[model samples]
Target: MGNLLGNWRFKEPSTVEECDSTWGSDSESDEPAAEDDSGISESVSPAESEWPPGNNGDLSPKLTDSPEFLPKMKRSFYAARDLYKYRHCYPNYKKSRQPNEYRNLRFYLNKIPLVPDGIYIEEILTRWRGDYDKLEHNHTYIQWLFPLREQGLNFYAHELTQDEIKEFQSTREAKRRFLAAYSLMLDFYGIKLLDKSGNVARSSKWQERFHHLNESQHNYLRITRILKSLGELGYEAFKAPLVRLFLEESLHRNTLPNMQHSILEYFVYTIRRPAARRHLLRYARQHYKPAHAFLWGPPPKRSKPKSGDVGASVGAGSSGIRAPAPTPEPQRRGGETSFIPASGCSGTLVSYHDATVCQDVDAESLNAYTPLGSSMDGPEGVFMMILERNNYSGAVPL
Candidate 1:
């Protein structure tokens, strides 16, 4: 079987010359295949390949061939950088940074630019003041003025004349808007309405207006706001007027409690002088009921029990016979006198009639006494102490 297979067949290997010829034909076909794989290789010239050639051996294309290419690249790079910088500046940039709607003319003014001119100011005032005859003209003026004012042109307020000021102040609407417009300017120019005596004329005007208004027609709330503003603006002249208002006989007591309270608050919290504070405390104690004494501060502290008294009380309690109740002290006419144990040996006794009077006395000296409770009597002692400490001796009449 082996002899038959050998005779039947395996061909001999090709010679080296034949092999070389065959490989040479295959290589010729492979050259075209390789060129097809890289289509741009044949299209690119040696001069183009040598482009941008330097000691650095940069392989990038020469942009100089196309004159517009470098400029366009530079522009694109700078534009991208600028865009990045702008985005970085406002990371959460949005169109709705400020509110569109305003609650009042004052708020609107704050949001707007300052446009200072007489015509523009009058036009704005007329619009807010609801002048129907000049409505159209005012509207047009406002539209133009709004943008300018938003740009911070405040010349309009300075351009106002005394007559214009008086006209504006004649109506509440115009007055409000005008005041809002010039509030900052008033501070800037140190503009104060003063008389020949250097007292604030506005305060006198307000006081006169207050007296003229009937109880039913009185705008206490508005008056209070104005007074508060004046006080905040360092107008000391108004304080006396406020005190007079508090004591006004024509004013309704029931209706004026809130106003009175506000006045007292100003006196108590705002006034720094010892005389002013003493006056306020005296007035409040004389006027305000004992129930309302908490407006000042906590009640006065009670005296602690003595060690000997505690032992005596305990011994009395241990006995079967109950201790007799102490006799009630005699009541004084018009008011009452009560004793309060204050400190060691000495106790404080207060008398209340039209006003309060306090005297420190030895507890052993009194014939009969009663411990003071949480009634109005406590504040009397506190007020008397305050008055005495401040050397205020003038008696307050009922």
Candidate 2:
């Protein structure tokens, strides 16, 4: 029975020891176990372990006795195991955050060899005015204007001729819309109106118009609008004249303090350039005490209650002139203080309540094919190819 059991163990190997004896050798091993001089078993070297050294291996400490090595080795082992186990989880993991469509369009626009001479002034004007289709193309046309302006086309201002300006000045029916558009464009570009002999003509005419309109108590809103545009443009030559006008108007005793405050705020905030700022500041210091106080001083302390009245309760008919019931704070108009204009035209006062008048265009939308760049056949094809390569499935309704 002992002989039979021993033979069965050799053949079937029920225990680990029996299995080792059956297959593994007790001596004459293919690879010998390594030992240190102290007779301690040593770990297999990475090379002997058949593990490829990772890219970061060169940055690791060479010393086998390093305290950091154990943690690093464990991390590497787990990372490798995880990577192997989950390799199929992220098939499309490596991709740029920015879409290829936008990248291609930006590249094409920025790297264009030449802006075609075929892009004429008339075409640019038509685009600016949204002359193609009023509803569908207006927003697109407006969007294109900024790019055109950035490219230094100056199409808006370029449309106005000396003849047109003269006609606009002399004729009441010379197209009010055109006149308004040209005025805005001229002011935006800081173009000083010049006469046939190249003399500055518009300054005196504008000043005379301002005085005449002021006397009639009419078109004050229009005048203020023009003044605001002129101030914002920071026409260098007009700085001194504007400063004088601002000081004279703002310092008048009859002018409401709120109007003065608005004017001062406009100068301080709107005209951003240094020269304009200094010009406004210099005159404001010399001529307007209220403006100076408003700009520099702490807000007027609310008329403080008397020290005697600190803890005292008073009846409705108190002896000390009770501060007229502090006027209930004016309900803010559309989340902003509406500035009353100098003319007290509350109706016409510009409300700065809507902060997002001009919003950022979506990068994806801007990168889509437009009339301006669609004319470029090569770039259009390349843009489409890039879109396809990126597996983009969105419809572009260009």
Candidate 3:
């Protein structure tokens, strides 16, 4: 989350410094701008770089928060890394890897916490559960507290492996700690993980919690990392709705400002529903930063067949990271289809994209939804009609 030297290689969860490299990098300099379906004219890509907080009045930069030591440690870490890197003289030289003690995923399951005076994950869950000041200010504790399958910029943690996940699940106490960690992060984001249904809902403190969220500089990045960790570490079902809530707040409620970049880049595509994705994308394009061509680069043009060979198109979405819709088309139609949301689906849409019970997607109100067939004529409801349009199964609540 800090500055780097040599060729810029910003980690995925890095801070705005990574985004500071000006646009028009060689790859994007000659790229053409095009209009999305929303009719907005711009190259389709995620935001160029996360602008540091000062630009937006909604988020004033916090001059101080992370204890002086954290940034000092980060600076020293980078400096030491460069000293040993010797990039120009020994580009191919391999340096012996030293095992970082803090890198271990299992270490957090123990009672100890990060930092000299940091609180344990359990304490963070209990005593600090509602403590905004401490939670907002803490920096290094996050990566250690909520471990992830993906390695973040925090050098303190190691790469999360599938084996580690299985080990985590098998250990009862560890599982409890991980679940508690989830609760702590969710509550901080103003969401409540329901006990009976195992779904997430708006917390009574959403308004207050949300205000605190906007007040801080780094919460969006934290939210980005947290969402990725949840989706990866077996809480996949809850991931979708948390994303939806942000999209709803920023796009619909107008309550969340300057968040268009995060929502579009990290949140929208996680939704597997074509209709919902398109609906949100179309509306969001106007407000969001023009995505880099690298992100929304042109779909490739089709090539004519030469002999038996077929030419591939990178621009045709062949090289994209997007997963194809699980059920791209329905084999059978005119049958009953349902939109049951998984655990985190209350008051939200239902689909593995993290939709909820039919109750929220009531047939009465869902009639206006365009994903459904035009008739909307049956008692089976609007979701039933929407499901007819795809190879729709249903959400199996976990």
lDDT of 2 by residue, 1-398 (tens): 99975454212212212211111211223233211100001111110011123354321112233332321211111111111111122221223333333211121133221133233223443343423123112222221211210111112211222232333335443233323333333332223434222123234234433343222211121223333333222222343444345455546532322233334433332232334444454556565542322231111234546778764533221211122211111121111222221221111111111111111224563343222122112111111011111222222111
RMSD of model 1 against the true structure: 44.7
Tens digits of per-residue lDDT for model 1, 341-387: 22332222111111122223234433233343322221112221111
- RMSD (Å) per prediction: 44.7, 34.4, 22.1
Worst 10 residues of 1 by lDDT: 36-45
Model-by-model lDDT, in order?
Answer: 0.27, 0.26, 0.42
Per-residue lDDT over 286-349 for candidate 3, one digit per residue giving the tens place of the 0 to 100 score: 4433221123222334675556564322234332223221111121121223332222212221
- State each candidate's clash count: 13, 0, 15
Q: How many pairs of residues in model 1 come into backbone collision? A: 13
What shift in Å separates residue 126 of candidate 2 from its native position after superposition? 13
Return whichever of 1 and 2 wins on lDDT: 1
Worst 10 residues of 3 by lDDT: 37-46
- The true-versus-predicted C-alpha distance at residue 398 of model 3, in Å, is 29
Clashing pairs in 2: none
Preferred candidate (lDDT higher): 1 or 3: 3
Ranking of predictions according to TM-score: 3, 2, 1
